[model samples]
Target: MTVLKKLPIVSAVFRKVWLQIAVLLVILIGNILLDLMPAQKEDIHGYTLYKRWAAFLGIFAVTWILVRVVSVLRASSVMGSRLAPNISALLFTSLRILIFVLGSLIALDSIGISITPLLASLGVGSIAVGLALQDTLSNLFSGFYLYVDRPIAAGDWVRLENGMEGQVGRIGWRSTHLLSSENTVIIPNSKLSNSSVLNFNLPFPTASFNLVFSVSYQADLDRVEDTVRAAAESALRDKSDLSAGTAPIIRFTKFNETSVELTLILKARSFPDQSELRHEVIKRIRKAFRQEENLGLDPQRIFRLVSNQSDLV
Candidate 1:
Protein backbone atom coordinates (compact mmCIF):
# COMPACT_ATOMS: atom_id res chain seq x y z
CA MET A 1 0.00 0.00 0.00
CA THR A 2 2.87 2.41 0.83
CA VAL A 3 4.48 1.58 -2.53
CA LEU A 4 1.17 2.19 -4.29
CA LYS A 5 0.81 5.54 -2.47
CA LYS A 6 4.24 6.67 -3.79
CA LEU A 7 3.57 5.27 -7.31
CA PRO A 8 2.87 7.67 -10.20
CA ILE A 9 -0.77 7.95 -11.32
CA VAL A 10 0.13 7.55 -15.05
CA SER A 11 2.10 4.35 -14.29
CA ALA A 12 -0.83 3.01 -12.26
CA VAL A 13 -3.13 3.38 -15.30
CA PHE A 14 -0.75 1.57 -17.69
CA ARG A 15 -0.22 -1.22 -15.14
CA LYS A 16 -3.91 -2.11 -15.41
CA VAL A 17 -3.30 -3.39 -18.96
CA TRP A 18 0.29 -4.70 -18.56
CA LEU A 19 0.09 -6.30 -15.10
CA GLN A 20 -0.33 -9.85 -16.51
CA ILE A 21 2.68 -9.44 -18.80
CA ALA A 22 4.77 -8.13 -15.87
CA VAL A 23 3.65 -11.14 -13.79
CA LEU A 24 4.81 -13.62 -16.46
CA LEU A 25 8.28 -12.01 -16.67
CA VAL A 26 8.65 -11.97 -12.86
CA ILE A 27 7.67 -15.67 -12.63
CA LEU A 28 10.36 -16.65 -15.16
CA ILE A 29 13.05 -14.72 -13.24
CA GLY A 30 11.99 -16.07 -9.85
CA ASN A 31 11.99 -19.68 -11.13
CA ILE A 32 15.64 -19.30 -12.23
CA LEU A 33 16.61 -17.76 -8.87
CA LEU A 34 14.76 -20.53 -6.98
CA ASP A 35 16.91 -23.17 -8.72
CA LEU A 36 20.01 -21.45 -7.21
CA MET A 37 18.52 -21.50 -3.66
CA PRO A 38 19.36 -24.12 -0.97
CA ALA A 39 18.47 -27.70 -2.14
CA GLN A 40 15.53 -28.19 0.29
CA LYS A 41 14.03 -24.68 -0.21
CA GLU A 42 14.61 -24.93 -3.99
CA ASP A 43 11.64 -27.36 -4.41
CA ILE A 44 10.09 -25.70 -7.52
CA HIS A 45 6.83 -27.68 -7.33
CA GLY A 46 5.39 -26.29 -4.07
CA TYR A 47 3.53 -23.30 -2.46
CA THR A 48 6.97 -21.65 -1.87
CA LEU A 49 7.31 -21.38 -5.65
CA TYR A 50 3.94 -19.58 -5.85
CA LYS A 51 4.93 -17.13 -3.10
CA ARG A 52 8.28 -16.33 -4.79
CA TRP A 53 6.54 -15.87 -8.16
CA ALA A 54 4.01 -13.47 -6.58
CA ALA A 55 6.79 -11.30 -5.13
CA PHE A 56 8.50 -11.20 -8.56
CA LEU A 57 5.21 -10.29 -10.20
CA GLY A 58 4.73 -7.44 -7.75
CA ILE A 59 8.19 -5.99 -8.53
CA PHE A 60 7.61 -6.31 -12.30
CA ALA A 61 4.23 -4.53 -12.04
CA VAL A 62 5.75 -1.64 -10.06
CA THR A 63 8.67 -1.25 -12.49
CA TRP A 64 6.39 -1.26 -15.54
CA ILE A 65 4.18 1.36 -13.90
CA LEU A 66 7.26 3.56 -13.32
CA VAL A 67 8.25 3.33 -16.95
CA ARG A 68 4.75 4.35 -18.04
CA VAL A 69 4.90 7.32 -15.69
CA VAL A 70 8.01 8.55 -17.49
CA SER A 71 6.42 7.90 -20.90
CA VAL A 72 3.38 10.01 -19.94
CA LEU A 73 5.55 12.99 -19.00
CA ARG A 74 7.60 12.70 -22.17
CA ALA A 75 4.53 12.32 -24.32
CA SER A 76 2.87 15.30 -22.63
CA SER A 77 5.84 17.54 -23.41
CA VAL A 78 5.77 16.53 -27.10
CA MET A 79 2.01 16.33 -27.58
CA GLY A 80 0.78 17.34 -31.04
CA SER A 81 -2.47 18.71 -29.58
CA ARG A 82 -0.43 21.64 -28.28
CA LEU A 83 0.64 22.42 -31.85
CA ALA A 84 -2.37 21.49 -34.00
CA PRO A 85 -5.40 19.43 -33.17
CA ASN A 86 -5.77 18.04 -36.67
CA ILE A 87 -2.33 16.46 -36.49
CA SER A 88 -2.58 15.40 -32.87
CA ALA A 89 -3.92 11.94 -33.72
CA LEU A 90 -0.99 11.28 -36.00
CA LEU A 91 1.51 12.43 -33.41
CA PHE A 92 0.01 10.44 -30.55
CA THR A 93 -0.30 7.26 -32.63
CA SER A 94 3.33 7.50 -33.70
CA LEU A 95 4.52 8.08 -30.14
CA ARG A 96 2.52 5.12 -28.85
CA ILE A 97 3.99 2.89 -31.59
CA LEU A 98 7.51 3.91 -30.58
CA ILE A 99 6.80 3.24 -26.94
CA PHE A 100 5.30 -0.17 -27.70
CA VAL A 101 8.20 -1.27 -29.91
CA LEU A 102 10.90 -0.21 -27.46
CA GLY A 103 9.11 -1.52 -24.37
CA SER A 104 8.30 -4.85 -26.06
CA LEU A 105 11.91 -5.36 -27.15
CA ILE A 106 13.20 -4.69 -23.62
CA ALA A 107 10.55 -6.86 -21.98
CA LEU A 108 11.21 -9.69 -24.47
CA ASP A 109 14.96 -9.61 -23.77
CA SER A 110 14.24 -9.79 -20.03
CA ILE A 111 12.28 -13.01 -20.76
CA GLY A 112 15.18 -14.41 -22.86
CA ILE A 113 13.61 -13.84 -26.26
CA SER A 114 16.05 -13.24 -29.19
CA ILE A 115 15.58 -9.98 -31.16
CA THR A 116 18.16 -10.36 -33.97
CA PRO A 117 15.78 -11.96 -36.46
CA LEU A 118 13.13 -9.29 -35.85
CA LEU A 119 15.63 -6.46 -36.40
CA ALA A 120 16.96 -8.06 -39.61
CA SER A 121 13.45 -8.46 -40.99
CA LEU A 122 12.65 -4.81 -40.21
CA GLY A 123 15.83 -3.63 -41.96
CA VAL A 124 15.03 -5.61 -45.11
CA GLY A 125 11.46 -4.26 -45.18
CA SER A 126 12.73 -0.70 -44.78
CA ILE A 127 15.06 -1.11 -47.76
CA ALA A 128 12.27 -2.46 -49.92
CA VAL A 129 9.99 0.46 -49.00
CA GLY A 130 12.75 2.97 -49.74
CA LEU A 131 13.31 1.49 -53.18
CA ALA A 132 9.60 1.49 -53.98
CA LEU A 133 9.12 5.14 -52.97
CA GLN A 134 12.30 6.75 -54.25
CA ASP A 135 10.59 9.55 -56.19
CA THR A 136 8.00 10.19 -53.48
CA LEU A 137 10.77 10.40 -50.89
CA SER A 138 12.62 12.96 -52.97
CA ASN A 139 9.54 15.15 -53.23
CA LEU A 140 8.84 14.83 -49.52
CA PHE A 141 12.38 15.89 -48.63
CA SER A 142 12.25 18.70 -51.16
CA GLY A 143 9.00 19.93 -49.66
CA PHE A 144 10.61 20.07 -46.23
CA TYR A 145 13.52 22.03 -47.66
CA LEU A 146 11.15 24.43 -49.38
CA TYR A 147 9.21 25.03 -46.18
CA VAL A 148 12.44 25.70 -44.31
CA ASP A 149 13.93 27.97 -46.98
CA ARG A 150 10.55 29.62 -47.66
CA PRO A 151 11.28 30.88 -51.19
CA ILE A 152 7.53 30.96 -51.79
CA ALA A 153 4.49 30.78 -49.51
CA ALA A 154 0.73 30.63 -49.70
CA GLY A 155 -0.90 33.76 -51.27
CA ASP A 156 2.24 34.74 -53.20
CA TRP A 157 1.72 35.67 -56.86
CA VAL A 158 4.20 33.65 -58.90
CA ARG A 159 5.14 33.18 -62.52
CA LEU A 160 5.99 29.61 -63.50
CA GLU A 161 8.35 28.46 -66.27
CA ASN A 162 5.37 27.66 -68.50
CA GLY A 163 4.31 31.35 -68.56
CA MET A 164 1.40 30.67 -66.21
CA GLU A 165 0.79 33.47 -63.70
CA GLY A 166 -1.06 32.59 -60.48
CA GLN A 167 -1.24 32.99 -56.73
CA VAL A 168 0.20 30.17 -54.65
CA GLY A 169 -2.81 28.65 -52.89
CA ARG A 170 -1.01 25.96 -50.93
CA ILE A 171 2.42 24.38 -50.41
CA GLY A 172 1.69 20.66 -50.29
CA TRP A 173 4.23 17.93 -49.59
CA ARG A 174 3.98 16.41 -53.07
CA SER A 175 2.68 19.39 -55.08
CA THR A 176 2.19 23.16 -55.03
CA HIS A 177 -1.33 24.37 -55.77
CA LEU A 178 -1.73 27.63 -57.70
CA LEU A 179 -4.87 29.60 -58.43
CA SER A 180 -4.74 31.62 -61.67
CA SER A 181 -7.25 33.87 -63.38
CA GLU A 182 -8.03 31.07 -65.82
CA ASN A 183 -7.77 27.92 -63.68
CA THR A 184 -6.15 26.08 -60.79
CA VAL A 185 -2.77 24.47 -61.46
CA ILE A 186 -1.03 21.71 -59.56
CA ILE A 187 2.76 21.80 -59.90
CA PRO A 188 4.74 18.85 -58.56
CA ASN A 189 7.24 19.60 -55.82
CA SER A 190 9.92 17.87 -57.93
CA LYS A 191 9.44 20.33 -60.78
CA LEU A 192 9.22 23.37 -58.51
CA SER A 193 12.32 22.28 -56.65
CA ASN A 194 14.37 22.11 -59.85
CA SER A 195 12.82 24.96 -61.87
CA SER A 196 12.74 28.73 -61.51
CA VAL A 197 9.98 30.51 -59.54
CA LEU A 198 9.11 34.20 -59.64
CA ASN A 199 7.38 35.31 -56.43
CA PHE A 200 6.04 38.85 -57.01
CA ASN A 201 4.36 39.31 -53.64
CA LEU A 202 7.47 39.16 -51.53
CA PRO A 203 10.00 41.75 -50.32
CA PHE A 204 7.39 44.25 -51.56
CA PRO A 205 3.82 44.03 -52.87
CA THR A 206 4.04 46.72 -55.54
CA ALA A 207 6.10 46.69 -58.76
CA SER A 208 6.69 48.82 -61.85
CA PHE A 209 5.00 48.21 -65.24
CA ASN A 210 5.69 49.76 -68.66
CA LEU A 211 3.18 51.04 -71.21
CA VAL A 212 4.10 52.00 -74.81
CA PHE A 213 2.02 54.69 -76.51
CA SER A 214 2.86 55.47 -80.15
CA VAL A 215 1.70 58.85 -81.51
CA SER A 216 1.54 60.18 -85.11
CA TYR A 217 4.68 62.06 -86.23
CA GLN A 218 2.55 65.08 -87.19
CA ALA A 219 1.28 65.45 -83.59
CA ASP A 220 2.69 68.17 -81.32
CA LEU A 221 5.45 66.47 -79.24
CA ASP A 222 5.21 68.93 -76.34
CA ARG A 223 1.40 68.71 -76.05
CA VAL A 224 1.51 64.90 -76.42
CA GLU A 225 3.99 64.61 -73.56
CA ASP A 226 1.93 66.89 -71.30
CA THR A 227 -1.30 65.10 -72.22
CA VAL A 228 0.21 61.67 -71.58
CA ARG A 229 1.62 62.83 -68.26
CA ALA A 230 -1.76 64.21 -67.16
CA ALA A 231 -3.45 60.98 -68.22
CA ALA A 232 -1.02 58.87 -66.24
CA GLU A 233 -1.36 61.04 -63.13
CA SER A 234 -5.13 60.90 -63.40
CA ALA A 235 -5.09 57.13 -63.71
CA LEU A 236 -3.04 56.74 -60.55
CA ARG A 237 -5.09 59.28 -58.60
CA ASP A 238 -8.40 57.66 -59.59
CA LYS A 239 -7.51 54.19 -58.32
CA SER A 240 -8.25 53.80 -54.61
CA ASP A 241 -6.71 50.33 -54.57
CA LEU A 242 -3.26 51.37 -55.81
CA SER A 243 -0.60 52.56 -53.42
CA ALA A 244 1.06 55.96 -53.99
CA GLY A 245 4.81 56.16 -54.19
CA THR A 246 6.85 57.42 -57.15
CA ALA A 247 5.36 59.71 -59.77
CA PRO A 248 4.53 58.24 -63.20
CA ILE A 249 7.30 58.71 -65.80
CA ILE A 250 6.50 59.72 -69.42
CA ARG A 251 9.48 59.59 -71.79
CA PHE A 252 10.00 59.72 -75.56
CA THR A 253 11.90 56.56 -76.51
CA LYS A 254 12.26 56.45 -80.34
CA PHE A 255 10.84 57.43 -83.74
CA ASN A 256 9.27 54.57 -85.69
CA GLU A 257 8.24 54.41 -89.37
CA THR A 258 5.03 56.42 -88.80
CA SER A 259 4.89 57.43 -85.12
CA VAL A 260 6.79 58.75 -82.09
CA GLU A 261 7.09 56.04 -79.41
CA LEU A 262 6.44 57.22 -75.87
CA THR A 263 6.95 54.96 -72.88
CA LEU A 264 4.97 55.38 -69.65
CA ILE A 265 6.24 53.71 -66.48
CA LEU A 266 4.06 53.39 -63.39
CA LYS A 267 3.89 51.24 -60.25
CA ALA A 268 1.02 48.81 -59.68
CA ARG A 269 -0.15 46.66 -56.78
CA SER A 270 0.17 43.48 -58.84
CA PHE A 271 0.41 42.03 -62.35
CA PRO A 272 -3.32 41.79 -62.91
CA ASP A 273 -3.92 45.42 -61.98
CA GLN A 274 -0.97 46.52 -64.13
CA SER A 275 -2.68 45.63 -67.41
CA GLU A 276 -5.88 47.41 -66.39
CA LEU A 277 -4.05 50.55 -65.30
CA ARG A 278 -2.06 50.68 -68.55
CA HIS A 279 -5.20 50.42 -70.69
CA GLU A 280 -6.99 53.11 -68.67
CA VAL A 281 -4.09 55.56 -68.97
CA ILE A 282 -3.73 54.92 -72.70
CA LYS A 283 -7.43 55.48 -73.31
CA ARG A 284 -7.38 58.78 -71.42
CA ILE A 285 -4.30 60.02 -73.29
CA ARG A 286 -5.83 59.14 -76.70
CA LYS A 287 -9.04 60.96 -75.74
CA ALA A 288 -7.16 64.07 -74.63
CA PHE A 289 -4.97 64.08 -77.77
CA ARG A 290 -7.98 63.76 -80.09
CA GLN A 291 -9.90 66.56 -78.33
CA GLU A 292 -7.04 68.99 -78.96
CA GLU A 293 -6.67 69.92 -82.66
CA ASN A 294 -3.01 70.99 -82.27
CA LEU A 295 -2.06 67.30 -81.91
CA GLY A 296 -2.09 66.48 -85.65
CA LEU A 297 -2.33 63.22 -87.63
CA ASP A 298 0.13 60.39 -86.99
CA PRO A 299 3.23 60.20 -89.28
CA GLN A 300 1.83 57.05 -90.87
CA ARG A 301 -0.90 59.15 -92.63
CA ILE A 302 1.17 62.39 -93.04
CA PHE A 303 3.81 60.73 -95.29
CA ARG A 304 3.98 61.86 -98.98
CA LEU A 305 3.83 59.09 -101.63
CA VAL A 306 6.52 59.53 -104.39
CA SER A 307 6.76 57.49 -107.65
CA ASN A 308 9.83 56.78 -109.79
CA GLN A 309 10.26 57.67 -113.55
CA SER A 310 8.91 54.20 -114.44
CA ASP A 311 5.45 55.32 -113.18
CA LEU A 312 5.37 58.12 -115.83
CA VAL A 313 5.56 55.39 -118.55
Candidate 2:
Protein backbone atom coordinates (compact mmCIF):
# COMPACT_ATOMS: atom_id res chain seq x y z
CA MET A 1 0.00 0.00 0.00
CA THR A 2 2.88 2.35 0.79
CA VAL A 3 4.51 1.56 -2.51
CA LEU A 4 1.16 1.91 -4.29
CA LYS A 5 0.60 5.33 -2.68
CA LYS A 6 4.08 6.40 -3.84
CA LEU A 7 3.29 5.24 -7.37
CA PRO A 8 1.05 8.28 -7.86
CA ILE A 9 3.69 10.64 -6.48
CA VAL A 10 6.37 9.08 -8.68
CA SER A 11 4.12 9.30 -11.68
CA ALA A 12 3.53 12.99 -11.14
CA VAL A 13 7.25 13.83 -11.07
CA PHE A 14 8.12 11.48 -13.92
CA ARG A 15 5.44 13.00 -16.09
CA LYS A 16 7.48 16.21 -16.30
CA VAL A 17 10.64 14.37 -17.43
CA TRP A 18 9.26 11.29 -19.09
CA LEU A 19 11.32 11.76 -22.25
CA GLN A 20 14.64 12.24 -20.43
CA ILE A 21 13.96 9.19 -18.23
CA ALA A 22 13.08 7.08 -21.27
CA VAL A 23 16.32 8.02 -23.04
CA LEU A 24 18.40 7.33 -19.91
CA LEU A 25 16.72 3.92 -19.47
CA VAL A 26 17.44 2.98 -23.07
CA ILE A 27 21.11 3.98 -22.66
CA LEU A 28 21.33 2.04 -19.40
CA ILE A 29 19.86 -1.08 -20.95
CA GLY A 30 22.16 -0.86 -23.98
CA ASN A 31 25.21 -0.36 -21.72
CA ILE A 32 24.21 -3.40 -19.64
CA LEU A 33 23.89 -5.56 -22.76
CA LEU A 34 27.27 -4.35 -24.02
CA ASP A 35 28.83 -5.19 -20.63
CA LEU A 36 27.38 -8.71 -20.68
CA MET A 37 28.76 -9.49 -24.18
CA PRO A 38 31.93 -11.62 -24.25
CA ALA A 39 35.13 -9.72 -25.09
CA GLN A 40 36.32 -11.98 -27.94
CA LYS A 41 32.89 -13.07 -29.19
CA GLU A 42 31.21 -9.66 -29.50
CA ASP A 43 30.65 -8.41 -33.06
CA ILE A 44 30.39 -4.71 -32.03
CA HIS A 45 32.97 -2.56 -30.18
CA GLY A 46 31.42 -3.08 -26.68
CA TYR A 47 34.35 -1.51 -24.75
CA THR A 48 34.15 1.80 -26.62
CA LEU A 49 30.35 1.81 -26.32
CA TYR A 50 30.57 1.31 -22.53
CA LYS A 51 33.15 4.08 -22.14
CA ARG A 52 30.98 6.62 -24.04
CA TRP A 53 27.92 5.60 -22.03
CA ALA A 54 29.80 5.98 -18.72
CA ALA A 55 31.02 9.46 -19.60
CA PHE A 56 27.59 10.67 -20.73
CA LEU A 57 25.83 9.21 -17.65
CA GLY A 58 28.38 10.65 -15.22
CA ILE A 59 28.09 14.20 -16.61
CA PHE A 60 24.29 14.05 -16.80
CA ALA A 61 23.95 12.75 -13.24
CA VAL A 62 26.21 15.46 -11.85
CA THR A 63 24.31 18.26 -13.60
CA TRP A 64 20.95 16.90 -12.51
CA ILE A 65 22.01 16.53 -8.87
CA LEU A 66 23.44 20.04 -8.74
CA VAL A 67 20.26 21.59 -10.17
CA ARG A 68 18.05 19.62 -7.78
CA VAL A 69 20.11 20.60 -4.75
CA VAL A 70 19.87 24.26 -5.72
CA SER A 71 16.11 24.04 -6.05
CA VAL A 72 15.77 22.39 -2.63
CA LEU A 73 17.97 24.92 -0.87
CA ARG A 74 16.12 27.86 -2.41
CA ALA A 75 12.73 26.62 -1.24
CA SER A 76 13.82 25.67 2.27
CA SER A 77 12.25 27.66 5.12
CA VAL A 78 15.48 27.71 7.15
CA MET A 79 16.70 30.58 5.00
CA GLY A 80 14.49 33.53 5.96
CA SER A 81 15.01 36.99 4.50
CA ARG A 82 13.58 39.18 1.77
CA LEU A 83 16.76 38.82 -0.25
CA ALA A 84 17.17 35.12 0.45
CA PRO A 85 15.56 33.91 -2.77
CA ASN A 86 17.70 35.98 -5.12
CA ILE A 87 20.84 35.41 -3.05
CA SER A 88 20.25 31.66 -2.92
CA ALA A 89 19.58 31.46 -6.62
CA LEU A 90 22.76 33.36 -7.44
CA LEU A 91 24.94 31.35 -5.03
CA PHE A 92 23.53 28.03 -6.21
CA THR A 93 23.88 28.87 -9.88
CA SER A 94 27.49 29.99 -9.44
CA LEU A 95 28.33 26.85 -7.43
CA ARG A 96 26.80 24.55 -10.05
CA ILE A 97 28.54 26.33 -12.90
CA LEU A 98 31.87 26.01 -11.11
CA ILE A 99 31.21 22.36 -10.34
CA PHE A 100 30.25 21.61 -13.92
CA VAL A 101 33.33 23.41 -15.30
CA LEU A 102 35.67 21.53 -12.95
CA GLY A 103 33.85 18.28 -13.63
CA SER A 104 34.12 18.80 -17.37
CA LEU A 105 37.87 19.49 -17.04
CA ILE A 106 38.30 16.29 -15.04
CA ALA A 107 36.18 14.25 -17.44
CA LEU A 108 38.19 15.62 -20.37
CA ASP A 109 41.41 14.79 -18.51
CA SER A 110 40.22 11.23 -17.89
CA ILE A 111 39.46 10.85 -21.60
CA GLY A 112 43.11 11.61 -22.41
CA ILE A 113 42.84 15.34 -23.19
CA SER A 114 46.09 17.27 -22.55
CA ILE A 115 45.16 19.58 -19.58
CA THR A 116 48.62 21.25 -19.28
CA PRO A 117 48.41 23.17 -22.56
CA LEU A 118 44.71 23.97 -21.90
CA LEU A 119 45.51 25.40 -18.46
CA ALA A 120 48.44 27.48 -19.77
CA SER A 121 46.42 28.83 -22.71
CA LEU A 122 43.44 29.64 -20.48
CA GLY A 123 45.67 31.46 -17.99
CA VAL A 124 47.16 33.72 -20.66
CA GLY A 125 43.77 34.33 -22.24
CA SER A 126 42.23 35.15 -18.83
CA ILE A 127 44.90 37.78 -18.19
CA ALA A 128 44.35 39.46 -21.52
CA VAL A 129 40.54 39.49 -21.16
CA GLY A 130 40.73 40.61 -17.54
CA LEU A 131 42.79 43.65 -18.48
CA ALA A 132 40.55 44.50 -21.41
CA LEU A 133 37.25 44.27 -19.50
CA GLN A 134 38.25 45.19 -15.99
CA ASP A 135 35.24 47.40 -15.30
CA THR A 136 32.71 44.82 -16.48
CA LEU A 137 34.40 42.07 -14.51
CA SER A 138 34.49 44.30 -11.47
CA ASN A 139 30.73 44.83 -11.71
CA LEU A 140 30.19 41.10 -12.13
CA PHE A 141 32.18 40.27 -9.01
CA SER A 142 30.56 43.16 -7.16
CA GLY A 143 27.16 41.73 -8.00
CA PHE A 144 28.30 38.39 -6.61
CA TYR A 145 29.40 40.04 -3.37
CA LEU A 146 26.11 41.93 -3.22
CA TYR A 147 24.26 38.66 -3.56
CA VAL A 148 26.26 37.11 -0.75
CA ASP A 149 25.87 40.14 1.52
CA ARG A 150 22.08 40.00 1.13
CA PRO A 151 21.67 43.73 1.78
CA ILE A 152 18.98 44.34 -0.85
CA ALA A 153 16.42 42.27 -2.71
CA ALA A 154 13.99 42.47 -5.59
CA GLY A 155 10.88 44.57 -4.58
CA ASP A 156 12.76 46.46 -1.87
CA TRP A 157 12.27 50.23 -1.80
CA VAL A 158 15.71 51.79 -1.83
CA ARG A 159 17.23 55.24 -2.13
CA LEU A 160 20.42 55.55 -4.11
CA GLU A 161 23.32 57.77 -3.16
CA ASN A 162 22.50 60.05 -6.08
CA GLY A 163 18.97 60.81 -4.84
CA MET A 164 17.23 58.23 -7.03
CA GLU A 165 14.46 56.29 -5.28
CA GLY A 166 12.81 53.12 -6.53
CA GLN A 167 11.78 49.54 -5.87
CA VAL A 168 14.18 46.87 -7.10
CA GLY A 169 12.70 44.90 -9.97
CA ARG A 170 15.40 42.45 -11.03
CA ILE A 171 19.01 41.60 -10.21
CA GLY A 172 20.88 40.66 -13.36
CA TRP A 173 24.45 39.57 -13.94
CA ARG A 174 25.51 43.00 -15.21
CA SER A 175 22.87 45.44 -13.92
CA THR A 176 20.11 45.81 -11.40
CA HIS A 177 16.70 47.02 -12.62
CA LEU A 178 14.82 49.55 -10.56
CA LEU A 179 11.13 50.42 -10.95
CA SER A 180 11.53 54.04 -9.94
CA SER A 181 8.89 56.67 -9.27
CA GLU A 182 9.60 58.26 -12.64
CA ASN A 183 10.43 55.21 -14.79
CA THR A 184 12.43 52.00 -15.01
CA VAL A 185 16.08 52.56 -14.10
CA ILE A 186 18.93 50.14 -14.80
CA ILE A 187 21.87 50.56 -12.44
CA PRO A 188 25.11 48.71 -13.11
CA ASN A 189 25.92 46.29 -10.33
CA SER A 190 29.44 47.68 -10.14
CA LYS A 191 28.19 51.18 -9.40
CA LEU A 192 25.75 49.92 -6.78
CA SER A 193 28.39 47.91 -4.92
CA ASN A 194 30.49 50.94 -4.02
CA SER A 195 27.64 53.32 -3.09
CA SER A 196 25.43 53.59 -0.04
CA VAL A 197 21.92 52.10 -0.46
CA LEU A 198 19.20 53.06 2.01
CA ASN A 199 16.59 50.26 2.17
CA PHE A 200 13.53 51.99 3.61
CA ASN A 201 11.16 49.04 3.40
CA LEU A 202 13.37 46.75 5.49
CA PRO A 203 13.29 49.10 8.47
CA PHE A 204 9.70 50.32 8.40
CA PRO A 205 6.51 49.65 6.47
CA THR A 206 5.00 53.12 7.05
CA ALA A 207 6.53 56.36 5.79
CA SER A 208 5.96 59.84 7.29
CA PHE A 209 5.41 63.05 5.33
CA ASN A 210 6.03 66.74 6.12
CA LEU A 211 4.03 69.20 4.00
CA VAL A 212 5.28 72.80 4.08
CA PHE A 213 3.21 75.80 3.00
CA SER A 214 3.00 79.52 3.65
CA VAL A 215 -0.02 81.65 4.66
CA SER A 216 -0.45 85.42 4.53
CA TYR A 217 1.06 87.39 7.46
CA GLN A 218 -2.28 88.99 8.48
CA ALA A 219 -3.88 85.55 9.06
CA ASP A 220 -4.89 84.83 12.67
CA LEU A 221 -1.93 82.80 14.04
CA ASP A 222 -4.13 80.56 16.17
CA ARG A 223 -6.76 80.12 13.42
CA VAL A 224 -4.09 79.41 10.87
CA GLU A 225 -2.66 76.69 13.05
CA ASP A 226 -6.15 75.40 13.83
CA THR A 227 -7.18 75.35 10.18
CA VAL A 228 -4.13 73.38 9.08
CA ARG A 229 -4.37 70.94 11.97
CA ALA A 230 -8.12 70.53 11.49
CA ALA A 231 -7.67 69.68 7.81
CA ALA A 232 -4.99 67.06 8.52
CA GLU A 233 -6.87 65.58 11.46
CA SER A 234 -10.10 65.28 9.50
CA ALA A 235 -8.41 63.80 6.46
CA LEU A 236 -6.61 61.26 8.62
CA ARG A 237 -9.55 60.74 10.98
CA ASP A 238 -11.31 57.87 9.23
CA LYS A 239 -8.01 56.01 8.89
CA SER A 240 -9.57 53.31 6.68
CA ASP A 241 -6.79 52.89 4.13
CA LEU A 242 -4.04 54.56 6.15
CA SER A 243 -2.14 52.88 8.99
CA ALA A 244 -3.56 53.81 12.42
CA GLY A 245 -2.20 55.65 15.46
CA THR A 246 -0.07 58.11 13.45
CA ALA A 247 -0.38 61.51 15.13
CA PRO A 248 -1.12 64.47 12.83
CA ILE A 249 0.99 67.57 13.52
CA ILE A 250 0.72 71.21 12.44
CA ARG A 251 3.14 73.91 13.62
CA PHE A 252 4.39 77.34 12.64
CA THR A 253 7.89 76.93 11.36
CA LYS A 254 9.02 80.54 10.71
CA PHE A 255 7.55 84.09 10.47
CA ASN A 256 8.36 85.75 7.16
CA GLU A 257 7.96 89.32 5.86
CA THR A 258 4.77 88.57 3.95
CA SER A 259 3.64 85.15 5.22
CA VAL A 260 4.01 82.49 7.88
CA GLU A 261 5.48 79.17 6.82
CA LEU A 262 3.84 76.15 8.42
CA THR A 263 4.83 72.48 8.54
CA LEU A 264 2.31 69.66 8.62
CA ILE A 265 3.51 66.12 9.29
CA LEU A 266 1.42 63.05 8.74
CA LYS A 267 1.95 59.32 8.23
CA ALA A 268 1.19 57.56 4.98
CA ARG A 269 0.30 53.88 4.94
CA SER A 270 2.10 53.53 1.65
CA PHE A 271 5.47 55.17 1.14
CA PRO A 272 5.32 55.50 -2.61
CA ASP A 273 2.07 57.48 -2.48
CA GLN A 274 3.42 60.35 -0.39
CA SER A 275 2.91 62.84 -3.19
CA GLU A 276 -0.73 61.88 -3.45
CA LEU A 277 -1.18 62.36 0.29
CA ARG A 278 0.44 65.78 0.17
CA HIS A 279 -1.81 66.84 -2.62
CA GLU A 280 -4.80 65.58 -0.64
CA VAL A 281 -3.78 67.55 2.44
CA ILE A 282 -3.35 70.72 0.42
CA LYS A 283 -6.66 70.21 -1.32
CA ARG A 284 -8.49 69.55 1.93
CA ILE A 285 -7.02 72.60 3.63
CA ARG A 286 -7.95 74.85 0.73
CA LYS A 287 -11.49 73.52 0.61
CA ALA A 288 -11.91 73.78 4.38
CA PHE A 289 -10.61 77.34 4.47
CA ARG A 290 -12.75 78.38 1.53
CA GLN A 291 -15.89 77.16 3.34
CA GLU A 292 -15.19 79.36 6.38
CA GLU A 293 -15.50 83.22 6.16
CA ASN A 294 -12.63 85.58 7.04
CA LEU A 295 -10.84 82.70 8.76
CA GLY A 296 -7.43 83.90 7.48
CA LEU A 297 -6.51 87.56 6.99
CA ASP A 298 -4.68 89.09 4.03
CA PRO A 299 -1.20 90.35 4.99
CA GLN A 300 -0.63 92.93 2.17
CA ARG A 301 -0.83 96.28 4.07
CA ILE A 302 -0.79 99.64 2.23
CA PHE A 303 0.80 102.89 3.61
CA ARG A 304 0.14 106.53 2.61
CA LEU A 305 2.77 109.38 2.82
CA VAL A 306 1.94 113.05 3.58
CA SER A 307 3.75 115.86 1.69
CA ASN A 308 5.99 118.46 3.47
CA GLN A 309 3.71 121.34 2.31
CA SER A 310 0.68 119.75 4.07
CA ASP A 311 2.72 119.52 7.32
CA LEU A 312 3.69 123.26 7.04
CA VAL A 313 0.01 124.37 6.45
> What does candidate 2's lDDT look like per residue over 105-221, in tens digits?
766765667788878988999899999999888878888777878678787878888989889998876789999767999999999988899876655656776776666655667
Question: Local distance difference test, per candidate?
Answer: 0.65, 0.67
Compose the digit string of candidate 1's lDDT tens values, residues 1-313.
5675575554455555466666667677876786677777634467464664455455555555555554464455344234333234434455566656766665555555688898899889989999999888778767766776888888888887778778888877777888988899998888888878877766776767766666677767786677778877877788737623568877888988887777767877765566676667666766665565454544334322121111000
TM per candidate comes to 0.62, 0.60
Task: Give the worst 10-residue stretch by lDDT in candidate 1.
Answer: 304-313
**Candidate 2 local distance difference test against the native:** 0.67
Identify the leading candidate in terms of TM-score. 1
TM-score of 2: 0.60
